[model samples]
Target: MDQIKLTMKELKAFIILWSTQSISTLGSSMTNFALIILSYQRYESALVTAMLSVCTYVPYVIMSIFAGAISDRWNKKYIMLASDSFAAFCTVFVWILLRNDRLEIWHLYALNALNGLMNTIQQPAADVTTSLLIPEKHYQKASGMRSFSNSLVNIVTPMIASTLLALTNIQTVILLDLITFVIAFLALLFFIKIPEIQKEKTTQETVLQSAKNGLKYMKQNRGILDLILFLAAINFTASMYNAALPAMILSKETGGEVALGVINMVTGISMLVGSIMVSLSPTPMSRVKVILNTLLLSMSTENFFLAFGNTLPIWCVGAVLGWIGIPIMNANMDVLFRSYIPLPMQGRIYSARNTLQFFTIPIGYFLGGVLVDRVFEPFMAIQPAQGVFVMFFGTGKGSGAAFLFFVLGVLGVVTCLVFRKDKNIRQLEQ
Candidate 1:
């Protein structure tokens, strides 16, 4: 009876945390969507747009290694609260700048970097808190809930921001974000209770040493290391596609922000369906196989359609198919990490994993931007009237990005196939 009661209490706490955090995430997503549209409108350069992501990720990748160790040592709740407060302040600052007409591309870049730094601290703390609050058996369900909220946010944020931009301005979208943040902040401060983790005090360890220990742990776990490396490769390719996507759609003669929003909404619905499926289904016998197979399916079909298809309907079809597998892949990956790593070490290990898996993203973003702006766009612009590239990708502004997507699709599939046969990765199933 006691164990059952404890389980119920923990589950309730997780639900509270999840709900509040999801609300906060929705706000953040709205601000991000609005900003992306704003940036693209002002500068009209893929590199400039991609730089925003680069700035955010550079700081995050740098800070995450140390932040994870700190999260393990500090009060997770306080860390989260502090991080959220700072992030809200950044949003407010952006609103102020816009109101004063002083906002510039560089300002957004700097603010995104600050937000990224805060997220490094907040993410590990939040991850640890969830691990502490939820039972091990419920990890997959919890992951699904997280994915559902994210997909819902993805669906709504684009619609909301685009509508608000049409009706009012970017300021209104930012204001709505602020309102949502306040609600989430108050709920987290007043309602959620995170259980304390008791740590064994055998010897004192420096932050550097703690961070290194995470690396050492991964070094020892060959399977986990291999998995992270494989993800790094995947992230690289995905980031390039993502960085180019906005420019691709906007540059098309028939495409615009509303078209992009519709595609995003369709993609989100597919992801929502996938999340629901994962939430209701039993744990798979081999998560490794599921991850690889889904990656194969998503990468091949989505990119193929997107690269070749010229119409919005075709783009929507690709978007939906591409996104459905993401939630399932993410849920299984979360379960794998939660199951394999010890609760106490999860913060550091997760941090380490983040560093390894995301390090390629900034590079990919930068290269994608440069390629689209300098290389591919110019090359496509000068292409002769008839060829395989022109026939498949269509000529003009968006064609370069289309060609890049095709390349990424081929590379993604090859990467998955090569990694699928790795002995270390297969061993994770055991």
Candidate 2:
């Protein structure tokens, strides 16, 4: 059998999309990274950062169904281009407000909510569009390119945000974010031409009936549901880490931005390396396997990594391992799902998936806040070492909270692993 590869033509089309997506993501990440730093610097509380984290996911929980419906009815390419432009304008306006030193935490919340709404529209559209642009044989390479672009954006922009925050202030970072999105918008508008993906006919079905049909299909295909649930658990678990990682590093006591930046850079580098490895060693293993293995290592290592803070080498090694493993699990799943689901209803299915799958992230954030600020702090008062405020690793009594997340992943992985014998798991790479 001849191996399928992406032609230069298709590669170019995908890259145009990928590059634009990367630029937009880079900008959003900068704001995201900056917002946490800003909140921590000013508020000096982990609670605020956790709120910001929760706000980021709240929109995903809210508009996921509507986002899916729009993608199903509309042209995704135009949606991508328009949403980027709209989001850029929102960023620009937010940047301007911040520039005058009128920045309020509420401003961050409101703008992020708007940004999340845009993302609710944009991300699913882009997710489905990958299959529209590239041939099946080329998925691994195409996926690598996307992963490469994501890692590279982090490599470039995250540190830039870090450096800018240190050297100047929030205003400049906001401006750069505004500019990057504009550049991304231009690339999508002028360079890419994605043909519309038509939805399958379900002429007689009611709305609930259509949703039921998709749900029934997924129910019968237990492996896909298993796959989705496993990742959902992992994502909910990881949300705690993501919500707190930067704060944990800064901590005024453990280390600071430099430490956070180092960890971030390591994570980005790990993702970069993982993308390359996946393309080289594409496999038929259930993506659940890949997710479980990486996240298991990540969750387990995270439980104990702070204990080794004196050993910079060990912490660095752990960071890279977690970073690489998690993204591989993620990238592979996208490929697998696309292969299994038909192109037409991908929007609606993914919409429902997004809505259901991410329902817990905000809960994770809110729970993290309550644990860190409310529970952990009180526990420390009761017993000093039991609730020790170790500023070095940013673990409060909330350390237990973090551990709980890791356990969630571990338990979820165990439940999903039993499905290895399921036929759907065996057929993804075909």
Candidate 3:
């Protein structure tokens, strides 16, 4: 394969796009941290937090197929602009409710649903646009840039929000998010021009038919489909961890707002470290190898520490090591997926791929909450009933969540081992 090098113009365009998106992400992360704090203050239930996760993620599974199909048929720039605009509007509305002191739990859920829908549309469009603007040789680098931005947001947002909340309010944090969205949308409208992807078939197909075609395309691509299914399972386990982590930390004796901030700071820094490593290094010869190794190592290390480590310092180490693998794994896997899919089909196929990969996320989120609140917490509370779990995870408020994390980590390791045995997955790059 000949490497496609990006020209100066393309590089300039990517820089502008990346800068604007990073600004927006930073603002959004602040608001996300603020909301998590707000929801915990009001509900004080792990189940509620998990439900919020579901509200945020379920829309992708619901709308990504349609959004992907629409993106393929339209100018991706306009799709992104529209999505950003709607998200900004939603933020303003939420701010208004907060100002009036009339904000409710349902309001947050509704806003999350709307935001998720907009993101579902924007995500595929943005990713496909990145692929279009950059040369094939630069996908991993671009992914690294994305990872860095995400890490920056995660690293700073929690600390910022914690301080801001002490001094101001959620309304102020949301207002900042709105401002960032405006900057991003304006940048897209004036500074950047995403070239329209040219498809061989000029005649437009019906929306449903186009979506059906995307599904059909995947059906014929058995290797890709199988890989997607495997990812879906991985996502399910990952979601459980995501849902449980906050509860575990917040409920533990050693954890508080400060501890949470520290954990997030370390996690972000670790991810940034991984992203920088990938960005600075030459692209891997085998993306599949990079992907599997990182996934197995990160998941195993993270869960093991959370399960066995009792103190904040010990857990923080685990958090950092576990997070470091994510960006490396993701950057490589993204390159693999991008290389396999044709550009024109990327919108549809990427959407379809994401829809499947995240299909089990809602279930994981819901179950994480229910199991933690109803099953695990109670089961671990009884001293005599502690059994083998006490030996591994100890007995206390967070013990249940720790046990759950252990199981998920072990499952993630098993998943990587299972995938290694599959011929299609092993040869995906070839």
Candidates' C-alpha lDDT: 0.88, 0.69, 0.84
Off by over 4 Å in 3: 1-9, 385-388
Instruction: Compose the digit string of candidate 2's lDDT tens values, residues 331-410.
Output: 77777778788887777678777866887788877776666556644554355453334433234433433343344446
**Candidate 2 segments whose C-alpha is farther than 4 A from its true place:** 1-6, 203-210, 285-288, 307-312, 385-430
**lDDT sort, best first:** 1, 3, 2
Q: All candidates' TM-scores? A: 0.97, 0.87, 0.95
lDDT of 3 by residue, 1-430 (tens): 1233434454778889998989998888898888887887688778887887799788978888877777887788988888888878878887888889998888878888888988898899988999988888778888999999888888998888888899987888888888888888888899898888877572277667767777888888777887788788888888888888888888888877778788898999999999999888896788878877887788779888988877889888998878898899889888888888888888888888878889899899999888889988888898465478788888778888888888888898898789877777777877
- Which candidate leads in TM-score? 1
Provide the clash count, candidate 1: 0
Per-residue lDDT over 249-359 for candidate 1, one digit per residue giving the tens place of the 0 to 100 score: 999987889888998898889999999999988989999988888888888877777789999999998988888988999999899989999888888998888888998
Which 10 successive residues of model 2 have the least lDDT summed? 386-395
* lDDT pick, better of 1 and 3: 1
Highest lDDT model number: 1
Clashes of 2: 1
